[model samples]
Target: MTLVYFPSHFKRAPAIFFFAFFLFTLGVTHFFGGSVSLLQAGESKAGLPYIVKKGDSLGEIALRYNVSVTAIKKWNKLTGDKIFEGQRLRIEPFPLHSYTVKSGDTLSEIALASNIPVSRLRELNKITGDRIYTGQKLQLVNDRKRTEKPSVHVVEKGESLWDIAKQYDISIAAIKKRNHLKTEVITPGMTLSLKEVPEEKHAKEKTDEEDPELFEYKVRPGDNLSTIAERFDVAVSLLKQLNGLKENRIYPGQTLQLRPTSLDEAVHVVRSGETLSSIAFKYRMNVSDIKRINEIEGSKIVVGQELRLKGAKPNVYIVERGDALWEVAQAYGMRVEELKRLNGLTSDRIYPGQELQLGIAPARPFGTYTVKKGDYLGRIARLHQMSVADLKSMNNMKTALIYPGDQLKVTPFLQQGSEWLKISEINWDDLMGSSGGLKKITLGNGPYYGSRPMARRQNNRRYYESARLSLWNTYKRAQKLQAALDRKIAKMGRLSDCLNGWHIVIDPGHGGLDPGAVVANLDGNGDKVYVVEDEYVYDVALRVYVMLRLHGADVTLTLLSPDHLIRHSDPPVQTFVNEKNEVYNSRAFNRGNSRSHWPKGGRNGNLSRRVAIAENAFKNVPRNRRMLLSFHADIDHSSPNVPLVLYYRNRRTGRPDRASKQFAKAIQPFLGAGTVIRGQNVFVLRNSPADISVMLELRNLAYTDHAWALRFEELRQRDAEKVVRGVVEYVKGKG
Candidate 1:
């Protein structure tokens, strides 16, 4: 028997292979009788299969197949430099095909013919569009078969109709048609069809143009049902019917429907002492026409009876006291010329109780707008070139509070000329001084006067002088009192005083499954060991918590220990298992009040849990007296060796809270001379419920000095003391 000694590295090879080789050596070759074959170097092409033979190593086989040794090893699953005879190996890379474009062949058609995506075809040939020349050689990669059937996609939060259509490489019109969506508003969790519809089907789809104009009108401060109906050229009854309004009462910013009139009919309410001829004359129609339309037997009409007018009728306004023709025209959102033409008047003249035609007003130029997330009155006003006060007035809003899905009227009636006085140009100081400084005060002798008053009362000049002296003394006393109050406030703002009754929540960043930033170091035995960020921060957090508690602070810790394990009966505890087969305590990760269950457990779940824990801790405490301090360590080698105190500012206002900034500044000195205190929008800081939320990146773990300092208990204790000192200072200096 021929002895075949395999290398030591190949000792872990498959047992079946060794058995087959052993049988082959014993001349029992029936199993591989015709399987063993070889490909010559000049006979094989890339991606073709080749059989191995005796005396052939991976390098030799790769050379024979005109491929790289790495490729050969990868294709055959060879762990080391070893191979067996009769083993089949892939000697080539993926194949490519070159196709000449034929007549009437588009890029999409060609891709479909080869079962490839058009995107892949374009990428292979660097083609920008479908304008491919006939007979042009286009390179095509042999990719996986494309799916011909339609797919379904569930809508996620923050996704719009345009976004979904773009993601699927389809048209928005096709999605709308398939889903039968009348509007572009799609809610989260709604299932949407992503199937590409044919051009013919798209042509038959209902479009926005075919739908009636249905708009939402926001009630302005001075708006009523009559004004809204007149503005949109619809009847007040129609507005009430569409909006389901039982009464004409509407508040500012209240949304109302401005739907099209059904069947092109207008309803008219008969007033007292009104005849059919007079009504017809007011509507600019013949008396017989009105009678026939209303089915009247004679010229008689009942008061408060309803009348239906044929076709469209112009909105009428009963001229009120002090109303002019021009003023009435402007108030109804019409030009003076248009009003006269519609009313067939010879000149601009109007009087009280006279009906004036305000013709169907033109469609509002500024259309209605829906409130979205992060929308406020100030923002909406700025976008539409109006003032917040005007927006509130137009919407009849008593306050600035607006929620998403609330409709607002963007367009307000533009008044002709100056409707209100311009006071910004007036000099207020001059006016106040010229008005003789309001009135003068007089002091009377009372309990402070002694029994020895005997002089006669003085003249007017003496009395005025005495009054001025008394006034001066009162002003001086007021100034002194204010100064005393200022001094008291300053004394109370000290760090110790501030922390005395404050509820401070400390969040130790990363725990359990999340190691945060990690670095490798050598132990005494020269063995590699990992230094985890969460461990160091947790140690520091415990020290800070103890220090704050000693300082009379009501402290709450988000993560109580490194292992995150909590007692079974501990309130508000989240239970989880760590990588070391150890159980730990954590908060149940939740986004909102309703989402209590954890979804897609992993890094995301851990972070959400951390935030939830902090938020819950904060909520149980008083809002005004709460503060959150999150501790973390950085691992950036290139970052400067310094501590960082980060706080969040409102994105809309673009400024951090004054107290938060003061707290950061107070803690900076204790952290070190190189410490940085800045405003940033970190997740924890932004979402924390505390009045003051700040994050402290203790030190750079990657730096040798910082890393070495963290290893020693004494050094970490000293650092924790410094942090406590900073917190004390921040609280004391809160004023």
Candidate 2:
């Protein structure tokens, strides 16, 4: 049976009832978590299909599978020992359970009930969203073994290892070892080895708890900390310390760990979005110390991966062919001595397959030497504390020849008043005050930075003072009020001068043949309705053009009308000639005559035209000007009510053209949230010489009322105003 779900109107009780029932059923499923096979049973030499009835239980499933009732319940993790009707259970004859979707289930909700994250659920179901309708087959966790064993309890919100251990009569340490927990702190979705445990062994294990063993606990409804603590016989403080929990409150699906002796040796779980540097910073320890303790070599950590803090070095790397000792050390983000000591290497030369130690190398002493023109290895070595042979050896150099660009590594003899200094993020004011400040400056390294020198040349970088005065009060007020907004903050003394006074052009999308969206009339005249996306766009463009021009910006259009401009020109098309262009052009050219549309007219319609316009606009502007923006309208053909906006990042030419992803980030939230996202490659912004170019999708005028259309027009005008405002801010160096 195919199950189709119509979106429930959230106003009624039936929807709420179904949703609650589904959650309840899922929660109850934890009891019978494994599978049973009927194929092995004599009951089914062939396949058989069974429909579920209201009063059926595990016994019926087992009978159907030719397996025992115990086997069926154990297989499916059914907590209530019962089943319902209109329910279809698969009799695979093999020990496997395939869950079928019920109404009102989201992927996140299902994943929570199944003791996993949405990612794992997606992997299991091969699904991307909570879009499953009733009757959809979903692969459940596969477990074939059947015993008198109790259902496995996963650590859920608000539960602790102690409670779980007591419930299952198992030792916390045994559970920890089974689940490979390093700390007493566990998380929701961690499966615990719950079985019929011996009381004496459990008691003995409890008495010895030190670095307590971690285990899983399923949270029961209405269970609180004080209640759970008394039941588990573990200190609430100990539990809190184990979980890094600040509050006593716990959720229904949270998992907590418990140990026998002392609280478990403190450890941290590397979570997603956490880097080793960040972890080290958070723990107030050096990254090297954490790395040394956890034995982690690279920055690869998946969410929920545990790290032991009991100080252990990671495995040493073996030197192979084409490996340089220093290079290898650098690869490990360490020094040669660190690598040598870790692997116990006593010599400079390392052959293929030679074992090398790996750990955080101890910090080295200060070293420095000035370069003497025309001085070779022997002279340079003598000036420093290193011998000629040692210098060559330390630097891994086979030759004595040194060039002007070569840096000599030397041991330093620190004298009084000698200090190392850097400009440390040059300030805009100071740089602007100096002559030729933007002329690619080299401080420590050659050609460190390249920037435009206009700030220095004009000596007008002081304009920031006035701009600052004008905006600071406004900014503080906005911040104080906590206005709904997006803000970008830059540290240090200077802003990007290259982005100032940028001349950008906007290209509104889908004009001419592309009569974009067709809105059916609610009236019963059989009257068809249509909106030429380009026409709506042109309205937007004219408003934008006037606004941008008023703000002293240079603007251009790719196409002025529905008639032939670049599309009808020779070379067959004026822009990006790809499949996307062809589709867009065909759509536009076909207009309302859907049948006469040219499928291959051009790929990525008007892309080339837009790019050409931007290119021309950029060339026409002064060398100091910046980027471009292409305007467009959202279209779904499926659901036009949900609009979309997208941008392009760096193009193939290595230019910093605006990324569509950024545009989507900037505008998507404004479109009423949760809009569908898509990517496109067009020519205009793609080919522009500007630092960045963006394509903006304004709105979906189809299916919109007259009021909505007016609002959309207003939004377009506001967006245009924002574009000019952003440009002015950029030019003033406030952005």
Which candidate has the highest TM-score of all?
1
lDDT (10s digit) by residue, model 2, range 182-262: 788877535555443332333334322211112334344687776655444344554554455689987654455542111
Model 1 residue 531 lDDT score: 48
Q: How much RMSD separates candidate 1 from the native structure?
A: 35.4
* Candidate 2: Cα lDDT at 719: 40
Error of 2 at 161 (Å): 12
lDDT of 2: 0.40
TM accuracy, model 2: 0.29
Per-structure clash totals for the candidates: 13, 56
Find the number of clashing residue pairs for candidate 2.
Answer: 56
Candidate 1 lDDT over 158-254, as tens digits, reads 6788877765667888788765567999875455545433434323534322211223444557778876665444456545644545788877645
- The lDDT for every candidate, in the order shown, is 0.48, 0.40
Kindly report which residue stretches of model 2 are placed more than 4 angstroms away from their true locations once superposed. 1-501, 517-532, 561-607, 624-626, 636-680, 689-691, 699-711, 730-735
Model 1 lDDT-worst window of ten: 28-37
